[model samples]
Target chain A: MGEPLLRVENVVKRFGGFQALGGVSLEVQPGERFGLIGPNGSGKTTLINCISGTLRNDEGRIFFRGQDITALPAHRRTWRGIARTFQIPRPFGTMTVLENLRVTLEYAARERARAGDPAVEAMEILAGVGLDPKAGAISGLLTQIEMRKLELARAMAAKPALLISDEAMAGLSSSEVDELLEILLRLNAAGTTVIMIEHIMRAVMRFSERIAVLDAGEKIAEGPPDKVVSDRAVERAYLGE
Target chain B: MQARWLLALAGVLIVGAFVVTRTVDNRYVYFAAYGILQYVLLATAWNILGGYTGYVNFGTGAFFALGAYTSVFLIQAVQAPLVVLIVAGGLVSGLLGFGIGYLTLRLRGVFFSIATLALAVVLETMMVNWEYVGGAKGISIIRPSAGPLFTNYVQLLFVVMAALAMGAVAVAWFIEHSRIGRGFATIRDNEEAAECMGVPTLRLKLLATTVSGCLMGIAGAPFPYYITFVEPVSAFNLSYAVNSLAMPMVGGTTSWVGPIIGAVLLGTLQQLATVTISSELNLLIVGVVLVAFVVLAPEGILGLLRRGTRRTRA
Candidate 1:
């Protein structure tokens, strides 16, 4: 295969004496749907945080599209087309929903040299996420599902090549989970690579082409979804057997 | 309104101040108007960082006093022109602001607030010990002779301040409508989210601090000339911090117009109160109005007006 879209090499993160991620490594291919799953406190979020530049790894080298980005700050990393959604929704509360997307389109995506009106572009992204009707509503007043949709739409506004959805379906109803899954699927079909960090087996299993399972700061299993799920170590990690 | 209209409004206001100076000879009018307009500048400056960027700076006195002292030093040493002093003062204070932001911006919320408050105290102590600027005893400055455009030095100073205040308002308005302003709003709302979304929160924050501090320093440049008594006590007065914050809080923190409204409304009231009641009641007026607004109109007058208009339209 061509160069991986994202290659993380032996990332280690520590919060004082507690090792949050101990030398975890992974690769995400271009336009591929990748899943990261683990039990709670299994370093899933920690690994992504290091990848996204939110938490700098104590020891690691991160390469994006062939350039070493380990020393780049979060905003620089974002400008390079890596975008992420928060586990909890974090909308710019004082702004309208459209304005939230405008922030990304104007800053993150501006590097792409898009030549159209940002407001129109923002509306298109909102429509894609099924949030166009609430464009003028204050984001702080959005319903939970709407807020989640806004989060995804805001991330998508960057026109990112690699999009990381971090627990985007947590606290969502089953139907809502399916709705978000459909959006992620649509995005992937349009040629955007996706890394979905999810606790919902049904959604991740259906969505991810391949899966990597992390447990206690280690990647215990990685392969096609069925093979990784059926692995004995993966079962032990989840079931505590 | 668009930026050009705001510029037009600012031009009209400066001309109006000039007309007021030309027609009315009451020195008291200039005095009262200068006090009000100074707050207009201070509140607007404070709102740039405290309101738009969501960073509270109790160090308003530090920046202001630093600007005043900058002028005081230049005046004693080289007798620089007022314009030069204003520029130098802005540069010095802006750099200090950028430094403080670099050091303390990583500490969010109340911790940041405390750092700024500590900054004011530390600077105040520095000024007190620096004997060249009269140390704790303060120094007095003799005003430059009036320029050809005005009758007395105070009148010219008043007009200069009026122009500066209007310039400050114009800059604030421009920032509010631009993309930079939107970046500021995101930083205000959520810094981490802003960074992840490519807002460059640190750079935008530094910009806010530099511009905010620069305007405040300009506001203080004319202060030593106006008061003619350059003392650490008065230059570093607690009123500078309180009024700057209170005016923005009472007017509204979201837009440029809020600080002007708050400064005008609260400032005029203080002038009237000092005459009718007592000078001691000046801070009390700010205290009462600030509490009332915090409880009844926390968004300030602009937010209240927006909500009212929206309700009527709906």
Candidate 2:
């Protein structure tokens, strides 16, 4: 717990003439519940893309558990125990919900898959995410909320040490958001470190033990939610005042 | 779905086909059989990348022609046996597939497809200019002595083609049920999500392309000997491209059975249409049938059949 679970130092990412992220540095402690809140187009997703290896950073180093992982591919980062959810749910429409979970479990827990039944384990994960009843249902047939649950279940199946949840509550009703928040909290309580990226202020403020705010490709504030809520810079960044 | 069951079924079908062909004792039957089975092989090979992994390979004709020409070159050089020629041809096409996939797989969607289509044109032009294998004038290979396994060359070739088609089906089935197939499914579903979930998408895509190309190339290996001549235009005909793509799309793309069903159904229909009516009408029939399938059942026959069962249950 003394060492950072993930470390990003001076990340700079650009697409052609536009700079998406500029010299952002951050550290996530092991077993920490961290929140990242940002306005639209504020480099939150880009920073995540660097950490997750979706896009390479033009400058900077990213480390996971003291190992330099800036150059690793996305699948390698996942194998190294970093799993992320997408902002938009992307379940395989042709497969059943259980099959979607099996893909992750089969790949990530390859050693476990050698000994145990992936179908049984996939059902267990579906049950965990409260999608057990829809295990056999085609993924495309799922409701919006169910799709989100399947996405989380798929991530959970990877058995990551650090879970980066990207807008898991997007487009959900308040009750659905609470349900998702509870699941995330329960998961964090069970020992997975969480870095939640969200636009939902209420969810972020309530879920975070420590929060970081991003505005226009810069970190505007870093502290507890209440402190960040009162910070002048954070207020000005959010309100553009 | 199971290996043992599939193996057993293949054994029965191979033996059954042999008995039926022998009983027919007609050259036209063997010729028709070979023509139809060729598509069975091509469609199965194309399905590996197209139906399963969802990568459009517009250069199947090039790969097929490459395989045939590889054999022509080998035959001209030392008169290599059909078996050796097939292996050499597959190796050449597999390497080409891998090379082209490496260059273009980075580009997604229509761009990648256009690259493959370009590959076909480039390769065909090279074949046209390169006079070693007679160039555009084409070359003919006299039939070689037959092995002890069969009484006649054509009969032996038919048996070999049948075996290859069955083997291709088996390979596709094995991939469909294995971990590799699941990885391919993930790629087909969503490449980005699959990558973040720990699936190595690029590696799997490369594998599918190589294997698919190799098999398509192998199917073309025996074609020159069967036709006794090879021309650049005929070898690289767009019919190979059209039929291979349409067969799997019309039959189904998601499972091993789809390509076989599509190839057999469409191939047999085309053969009959060619015999009974104008040969040029075959292409129109394929186009119309493909358009109908795309409009009515984009998932193909397997999907359409599943819908039928769903209605009964409801």
User: Which is the leading candidate under lDDT?
Assistant: 1
Clashes of each: 0, 0
What TM-score against the true fold does each predicted structure earn?
0.99, 0.98
Which lDDT tens digits does candidate 2 get at residues B104-178? 446787888889899999999999988988699999888887677555677777888999999999999989988
Question: Would you give me the overall lDDT of model 1?
Answer: 0.92
Give a tens-digit lDDT track for model 1, residues B249-273.
Answer: 9999999988999999999999999
lDDT of each: 0.92, 0.89
Model 2 residue runs over 4 Å out of place are: A111-115
Residue A199 shift from truth in candidate 2, angstroms: 1.8
Residues A22-124, candidate 2, lDDT per residue (tens digit)?
A: 8888889988899998889999988898899988999989999999999999999988888888888889888899899898888876643334788988898
For each candidate, report its DockQ versus the true two-chain complex: 0.88, 0.84
RMSD of each: 1.0, 1.4
Native-referenced DockQ of model 2 = 0.84
